[model samples]
Target: MDTLQILSEQGVLGSTPTVRLQGEALDLSSYARTEDAEHLRSLYSDMFLVRRFDQESTALQRQGQLALWVPLTGQEGAQIGSGRALERQDYAFPTYREHGVAFTRGVEPAELLRLFRGVTNGGWDPRKSNFHLYTLVLAAQCLHAVGYAMGLQRDQLADPSLPPAASIAYFGDGASSEGDVHESMVFAASFKAPVVFFCQNNQWAISVPATVQTSVPLAQRAEGYGFPGIRVDGNDVIAVEAVTRWALEHARSGKGPVLIEAYTYRMSAHTTADDPTKYRLSRDELEWKARDPLLRLETYLRSAGLADDAFFEGLDTRARAAATELRESVRSMQSADLEDRFAAVYAEPHPLVQEELAFFREYEAGFIDDGQHS
Candidate 1:
């Protein structure tokens, strides 16, 4: 089936989407196929943890522990679902907002917070974690992911005995419009790079609506670069996980890149500084709120008899503890020395850099040695 054609038929005025994921408009019974009661309970636990982390990060930002916080108040399904789909051998490139994904991948929450808090560029090594440094530049990670996938292909060639490694690039709907993203698609397709371009179409790019970014669905654009595209109910964690797992397997098996557009809403302001109300209609907000990811999971869990008051209470307790721990960690992140930033930019210090560092060391010593603000 042509996935692009499937997308074209979706989101049209007054037209029903053929792929109505479980729990889109009905009770939680529909979501039962994806998991048994035990697994559902675990996923709910995961969602709670992610939300707790998000709330703590936000509070830290407001309290001056972090320089900024990009909250994913309503998009936990997309991140956790897509993240859970990745194999340990697979690589992932993430945009800055994918804290939930990082969390699912076992990234230490403290390390992620330190990046936004401005204590470091990236606190963790990408190679060690199976995750790349969070890309603040929109769509740049797409190119990096493509390069990584190509390198994986070369490695597979050098050692024909080795298994192929899939790469996943996470980007937003706004980033889908970037030229580098398009170039990434071109290169991935041309090289048959084993990559999945996972786009979280959260329906807003700060103040810009998805309508303004492109007339067609972002997933359909994958056809232009000779890749299949699948649009899933992003709020439905089951749907997102099922679709991403399928897409990732296809890519890993040498089918090249697949664009999985998880159709979700951006429930929060774009960032701490963004006022979504300035540009978004209240009606749209209300409509999207009704599709809240956590609510859906809650409904499903209750209907399936997978979660009870005890379950919820346990989750709440864990969430609270996590938040407290995260708060402390954010507070404890020590500021890096200013010189360390310049030191890592080169292998051996160049002559000019040596001279500048020497001058700065002396110049800085003249001032108070406390590196509090530096």
Candidate 2:
């Protein structure tokens, strides 16, 4: 069946309002009161910094400083809002493009560059920040998140006094097609795992459009798993934050899993190596640009008199400084020794690893002794 017909049949396109707060025509009373002026400005700053960082990373990739970069240009609101909603005790599993989420979780930008620069297998300690490493394998983190949530359930049962904790699994519309996501959701439902399946439906999964990904709204899929699901305007940071906070609370209070389908757009290429112009039309890009997350928040802040030019200026300065620092760090990054790769393969010494390492050493020695074969 066609996507529209399928959505109609499933009643997935029913009148569930997309949660929105800051927009030209939206009623803000329902959502605007939750955050104070300072908090609003902070959210704006977070979005600004993330965008700047994304731009810098893209530039670095273009300049040949990095091997690849996944741009999160149009999805800043979805990432920042949902990311900031997490508690310190909570854990997050991110897909490879969750740069804004990492920023919100206190991950250093330089550390993030380490992975893209090919200097490290993983960047930063997951335990230290409660934010797991980026999973390049599509939909793999969803299963990991569900398992972690089940473990958290067991841990909570052992110590009732422990503070409530939830795990969030971040995936994309593309990954939704993976069997692993289905299995994760099924297990989460059966086990009543305290997890939030956060899907950033950024319109395009590489070159494929959302229309091809599924027939119904991605959020509606949660109902099949016997959990509540909601759609939030992913470009509206206020709405994203409000919905995420509510979802997190529900899961933390033992309500089981919740699915949040963030309706957003991928304004840039899927990655540095992609060319969106080959598939997506310019008119669609223009439409999403008008609904830019950063622009909406900045407009709201200015209209409400919540922030002044000085605040914006200072923020810009900070962003530039941060970008400079990241560039310098990435350029100065030292490559790991070739032996370190072999050494990290096993916790204990292994004969196979030793043999491989020996072979590699002999090969290097042969190259060093003379220009010709030894």
Candidate 3:
């Protein structure tokens, strides 16, 4: 199918609309009571800051400050909208490129850089933020999310005082093919785990196009597991948020898991190491650019008079300041001691770990005082 036809079929482009609250030709009442001005402004601010964070990290990688960086430029709406839908008790298991979701979860941008900088395995405590560490291995976190959801179910049954909670597993179209995701869905279905399988179908999984991922829509896979699946216009933040909210609520209420296929496009390279020019067409990129998430929301804000020059100008200033702070923080980060790597290899000292540490020490001792090989 053509790009326009595919997107239109998925409710991402052209005439058939998905749920939306703020848009040029859309009625707000159809979604919910019109979102208050403050709420709308907050959503815009979150998207802007996350985009700035992404840009700063990409620059850092280019400057050799970070080992690698994953850019989430075009997927901001899908991440932010679904992230904001989570309740405080809910948990999220994210793939490496969920900077926007991490932003919504109250994680510091600098902390997220620590892993990419090779300073730590995980930059933050999952318990503290209810956001799991970035999972580098594809689809691994989906299993973890399902297990955690089962635990939440047990806890809720054991203690009535505890609020209902659900878990969200964030993966991409590429990771969906992994056996781990399939196993996770099977276990979740059999156990009726309260987990949401949130797939960001960004069109391209690394260099491979979505056409190669599956012949049918990714959402339809949920039906085989005995659950409902939804396809949302991922670029439409309002629609994403609404759909995610409903999905989360359904799971939290003990209706079992839901799979959300967020039909979106990856406007940037998959990661800093990738070059989209090698595989994707320039025309396709330009077409998706017109459907930019931030631009559409900005249009709604301006049309509704909810935001003005002062608001935009102030937002720009804040985004720039945040980016500067992030860059400086990453550059100023100190490397951990070599011994520190072995310290956490085992909870307690293990014979194998000790032997490896000794070998590492002996290897370091071989270096000459002049910093040349002896």
Question: Candidate 1, residues 259-353: lDDT per residue as tens digits?
Answer: 98888888887888778889989898788787777887898788767788998998899888878888777777788887887787798878888
The whole-model C-alpha lDDT of candidate 3 against the native structure comes to 0.86
Model 2 TM-score, all chains together: 0.90
Per-residue lDDT over 1-374 for candidate 2, one digit per residue giving the tens place of the 0 to 100 score: 00000112222332333442221122323434334889888888999999999999999999999999999999999999899989999999999999999998999999999999999999799998999999999999999999999999999999999999999999999999999999999999998899999999988889998889998789889888998777677877877877777778889899899998888899999999999999989998998898798998788789878899999999999999999999999999998998898889999989999999999889788676456655
Q: Which window of 10 residues has the lowest lDDT sum in candidate 1?
A: 1-10
List candidate 2 segments past 4 Å from native.
Answer: 1-35, 362-374
TM-score of each: 0.88, 0.90, 0.92
**lDDT scores of the candidates, listed in order:** 0.80, 0.86, 0.86
Evaluate model 1: give its TM-score.
0.88
Better of 1 and 2 by TM-score: 2
Per-residue CA lDDT of model 3 for 1-374, tens digit only, reads 00111234434466556432111132223333235788778888999899989988899999999999999999998999899989999999999999999999999999999999999888999888899999989999999999999999999999979999999999999999999999999999999999999999999999999989998788879989998777777887777776788788889999999998889899999999999999999999998998888997898889888999999999999999988888889988888887788888878888998899899888888885687777
